[model samples]
Target: MMRNKIIEMRGIVKSYYLGTPNELEILHGIDLDVYEGEFLSIIGASGSGKSTLMNILGALDRPTKGHYYLDHLPMENVRDDGLSQIRNKKIGFVFQTFNLIPRSTALKNVALPMLYGGVPRSERSRRAAELLQLVEMSGRSHHRPNELSGGQKQRVAIARAMANNPAIILADEPTGALDTHTGRLVMDIFHRLHQEQGKTIILITHNAELAEETERTIRLRDGSIVDNRMNGHYQLEACNESV
Candidate 1:
């Protein structure tokens, strides 16, 4: 069967301070394709432009010169509102900070995406509860972020990412802020999600060890793709080990 490409980016160039004397270029003409249900990782150093690429991929920012087709929709010329809608409907983000509302309960945080998507209140609550259960945070549903551990907060963020059933789950250094045990557990959740839910996941991290666990790894260097390789093996046991 021919695999469907969920994300297609070609000649993706991102620059800042355009038309200014102090202009700087970040991503230097990137080309990438991610198929549906694939587990992929992009690993890079501090100045490799991983964040810039991610922002463009997540539709949070536009590229200076490039063509990005996310789920077959052209993202290059999309308006801000259109991009916002695309982000809500097609992309789920899991950030290092967990990005949950401090005052909201875990359930409320998980339900926020659904709320923005205009899901009915009854259905939203039901799905949010289900997602929390998926991430093993059902018991903490009523607790706020301040009351949760780092791992717990990350799990809640994961649940929220699944709220809209997005085309892709973009995880940016998801395990960066947790302890070894907690990070391993978080990684396990991602592995389970990919195997069980068949989520199309793209992980962005600077850890080479973590990147190797994914099905494919793309290495960036100074704003350019230095290496792109398919690991073929999932390395589940290896991923279970600490990074």
Candidate 2:
């Protein structure tokens, strides 16, 4: 079976200040394609334009030039309102900061996205509970962010990201703040999501070791992709207990 293209970027050029003297180009005519159900990483150092590309991929920003086809929709022409809808419906984001509301319980934080999507009160609560269970955070459903440890907070964040059942999960520096063992636990969850649930995942990270765990990697340097490679699965001893 031929896999569908979830993302296609052609002639992608991102620039700041289009016509002014301070105009700076970040991504230079980059072309790329991401297929459905694939696990891939975008690896780059600081100032490599990875962040700029991430914003474009997430539909938070548009390319200064070129066509961005996300799920076959032309993103360059999408208005802010339309893009907002796409972000809410099509992409799940997991960040290093665990961007949860400090005062909201784990259940409430997981339910927040569905609430924005206008899911009914009962359905939201039910689905949020399910998502927390999937992330193995069911026991902490009533805990606030301040009450959880770093890894626990991240698990809650991942659950919240999965609430809307978005087609793609975009994780940026997901394990950056964790110790080695905790990072392994988080990576294992992502692996299960891709292998078991068939979720398409794009991880943006500077950690080469972490990137190697994914099936493939696109390495960026100085606004260009320097290397794209398929990786052998590197094994790490993950916690046998639930995340």
Candidate 3:
């Protein structure tokens, strides 16, 4: 069963430089809540602090001032080692860059996270193959990053993201590198993940059009939320199951 809220943020304030006069505050006292199994998108132009907020959400960074909770666990002020464990176990990240190992096969890339989590080699490989199949990449499991097209690499990356069965998937411009058609394909996979698997997906994008595909959209401007509302595209059944 899913929790009432998978993520919650209160009084989030992020800044560069601790106490000096040159400190640049990127996020200003923001409050947000995301329910379990929801598809959410955060949209903003460059310099709007969207990326900074994503970093904090993914446990890559902590707020300069604020409180954040993931699965009801406080995220602020955690030690580096603790943060790393939480990131690996609780969150999955997909980036526009398709950060796959150039020399690793698609199956190996998908299996990497499980490897880090200390799953047995045989079991990791078995689970990796299953995840690759989930993303419709089973036929290309042997291909390396250099051998695949941008979309194919991204599919592999998506499979890799799902390897650990994380509580949330945080995508940073996931479709930004693909062409329009390919981008739609990637988005379709995300939708299937959300609707069929009930994944809690947090997509970060500057494209308003892409953001509209999600159930809820949050627009940020100048370090503050300008809009937070539900889109008509939300499907009630999407949050009902986990595959």
Clashes of each: 0, 0, 0
Best prediction by lDDT: 1
lDDT of 3 by residue, 81-140 (tens): 999888888899999999999989999999998988889999999999999999899999
Model 2, 1-243: lDDT tens digits are 467999999989999996778889999988888989989899999999999999999988989999999898888678888998888888998998989999899999999989888899999999999999998999999999999999999999998888888888999999999988999999999999999999999999999999988977999998998897677732221122122
Point to the candidate with the largest TM-score.
1
lDDT of 2: 0.90
Note the Cα lDDT for every prediction shown. 0.94, 0.90, 0.92
lDDT tens per residue, model 1, 110-203:
9998898999999999999999999999999999999999999999999999999999999999999998899999999999999999999999
| Clash list (residue pairs), candidate 3 | none
Where does candidate 2 stray beyond 4 Å? 233-243
Selected candidate, larger TM-score, 1 vs 3: 1
- For all predicted structures, in order, the TM-scores are 0.95, 0.94, 0.94
RMSD of each: 4.5, 5.7, 3.5
Stretches > 4 Å off in candidate 3 = 1-3, 233-243
